[model samples]
Target: MIGYWIIFSATTGNEFSYLTKHFLFNFNNVEDIFYRNYGKRAFIMMKIYSFLLTLPLALLACIPVRAGVYEPDKLRVYLKMDKRVLYSDEDVVLQICIKNVSEKKNFFDVFDSIKNKPGEYTTFQPLVYDYSGREAEITVPYKLEKRDIKELIRDLERRMVELAPGEVFIHSINLKHIYKLDLNTRYRVKSLFYPTIGEDIVITSDNELSFKIIAEKRYNKPSEREAVQRNISPSEVILLTLRAEKDKNWDNYLKYIDVEKFINAYPEYTQKYLRANFEEKNQIEKDFIKYLTRDRDDYLLHYKIMEEEIENSKRIAYVNVIEDRYGSRWNYRYRCRYMLEQYKDMWLIVDEVATVMQGAKR
Candidate 1:
């Protein structure tokens, strides 16, 4: 048994020694093989992982962004007239004011200045006062930006200096400018070729002008008024003549001379017709003469003396030809308000009130 044990122990020891030597001998080669083939695989894997991690960043760098252009808004202009009714050839004063609300550049020019041509609108420019007169030549270049405002004022005195005699100047404005913009490349869509934008700087501009010109004095002559001789109605003449004859001694022969007195009292009342020799025999002439002769004296003194004699002379009731006594026809004097308009030939009562004198100049 002891011999068998010793032999087994020796065999086990030799097997152990052989396994340890073989492991030590192949260790270097195994390491070399791992580093050559597997190392390359690991390096390749690392490169793929790095690429995956950076892929999103690379895509973000190439992505497009939107761009835009901006501009300011424009303002508008308005005008008004104080009066509209004007007499022909009358000199009128016009007030002009200009305003702007915007961020942009604009220019203006006026007519009448030597530099300005005919049919051109006027602008506010610097003027110089010299020995000769006030001269406007230097122009002001105006620059504005967003929410900016500009104002200009003018009076008729300056306007008259520039205005030509008998030449009518039509005032107006012009908006010929626009805002420019450069779009960002983000909107560089294939459909569009250029990166530009355009917008109106003036939201509201001068669309129309409110203006008027009038003459200082009326061009019409006073002689243009329709004129005629006053004539008493036949009924009135008859009543007045009869009253005169009744008050005095009624005599058939006295009637003839009384008619001359009646005519003298109310001078030239339809004298043309009375003097005219009409071929037709008419009762109107006889009746007219008789009517005048009857009240010749009293009719003549009615306004001059009779009205003065009557205490608290009753208001003489009057009825116009139109027969509308209730209609207003009088007005307050020196307190008349007026509107501007081309005066018509027809006469207009100052105000449609109810008490005043009806008078005519021509």
Candidate 2:
């Protein structure tokens, strides 16, 4: 019997070696004369059997050149988490970004054959481990390995997505939905990306993100957001937010600005947050705010209100501010423009756009 892949190769019009095709042509003619001579038929049958035995091997010997991010040199998979510590009520989110690093652009990406988005559909097959060295459970619809490799390869080749050099495709994975994460435990997530779906070609990113889930934080007091919300100008709101950031007053700092809207300013965050569930939305906010509150030397050093614009019958305002920022390694001066909106008596910063200035100091 012909092997399934041999049939697939023929049906798909995969070119065989010239010698193999020539022999196959002759073998087809030989099969018609089986009744004429038993001796000739037996010899032809032996040759046919040998050809069948070696066909698969021949196919393997000249495997097609795999496209996409198959090797470390071609692409990079980065796994990252905004928050390393989370409350039990929050979702554990992991961001997977695949970047094309090769000089040549790829027309077909690994994600094409995947049913939904890779991380969203659990096709990433992410491995999660608790602090105790026990792996978390992940139940999914189907395993790729059980399916026909030829089918996977064929589907992958058919899907065309142009990924240029330095371009990235990002996906989100919520471990909270995939794994049974328990409270008060630490876990590490390592992700696998398939540029070509196979055991040998999986790209295992060296990056691993670990986070701890503790009991819900209920003791934290609600900020006196009312204090900063009333009768404030756009420039004042910017100053207040900067002061709160410098003082490490996260609760009050986030109150001066629309946290969700500000985080959504980033394209990546906007894409994920727009489709997120209630729990995931809250987790995203927490991760973003918590990240901003973390200790860093790059806090706003100085800012000057360069210009201000108020419109929409004074309900909307914009402020152009020059800022100085420095970390242990580097320093930069930026010109930032902020957008603020007035709701009732409260003026809240909703958006900000910034550009770097090449200079010695502000």
Candidate 3:
């Protein structure tokens, strides 16, 4: 029986090699007990017991090992855009930020300055997606002589910079010069970074940034006559808020908000809270715009008023807004309160409170 078990175990070397060594001492003790006390009658019973005990171990050994989802390296990279919406004539500024999250210092080769010439360091490759869903790689063109390349390599070899833990290195490049953009078309851009010229370590952006080119401004300053003629309601104010953020029109957005009433209603917000002193109305308006647009993009897919309550000159509305970002949809439900006031004989939006409901994401 022992010889039979040995032959069965030897057939599966790779799968049960480590486990066989672990169970060998115990199996030897069991075999000694069976041979000394029970003799031949218990030999067949011992063989059956050994087979049952090793069955689970054999099954476990056949299972494949899986790798972890997270990356082992401690370096983090991110890309940001200065503006989400741009004109065709304007240059798009793309910034790259790299940070070392590990405790140890890491060395990286970067193009800090133009010491010799071009082709000294690794260039960034940007992925561009057009409105027609066509994707293309846009590369920056560079020309370098043989001597320039040699000098650049020498410069890069000597210019290896050390990054301490939690330290960030930032670089900015103009994409408009590298790639030509079409007017009235939306483009999504993602920047890829390589830490070394040999393409050893690579990190991509956390999220892609998109920008739309417009032939003319969708939002403009309304004249005094137009402002007076427009009837401002709570629902209209909500619509204006969405349109203003979509157009990045801060000036037109401010017209719909009553700054004094908002400050008085939400007095907990101070200069430190806003990161800017709100001594002037313009500064307060800017701070308010920043608060409303925080962590949001300049595009809205859909919006609906979930519920509304109106009594006398006050109203409260629960609005649902959906935004599509990088092929993922995010739903934001806001509970907004509004107070109606007479301004130049027209009902204007005065005080307001906007709170995001819990579990607002789908």
Q: Which candidate is the best by lDDT?
A: 2
- Which residue runs does candidate 1 get wrong by more than 4 Å? 1-75, 92-96, 103-112, 115-362
Clash totals for all candidate models: 24, 0, 0
Off by over 4 Å in 2: 1-73, 107-123, 143-160, 219-362
Candidate 3 per-residue lDDT, tens place, 82-127, comes to: 7888765567788877777877776566654454444323545566
Better of 1 and 3 by TM-score: 3
**Which pairs clash inside model 3?**
none
- lDDT string for model 1 (138-175, tens) is 22222222221122112111122122222222332221
TM-score of each: 0.16, 0.36, 0.34
The lDDT for every candidate, in the order shown, is 0.30, 0.70, 0.60
Q: What's the C-alpha lDDT at position 356 in model 3?
A: 59
Clashing pairs in 2: none
lDDT of 2 by residue, 1-362 (tens): 24322432453233345324544666664333332433565646656776888898899989876454434457777888889999986778888887887876754344443465232332354788987889876654234336544444544323434577788877677777667787777788888766545444577776988888888979677569944655667788888888888778878898887887788667767888899999999998888777768987667777888898999599889999998887565567899989988877778888888899844533
**Could you tell me how far off, in angstroms, the CA of residue 252 lies in candidate 3 after the best superposition?**
55
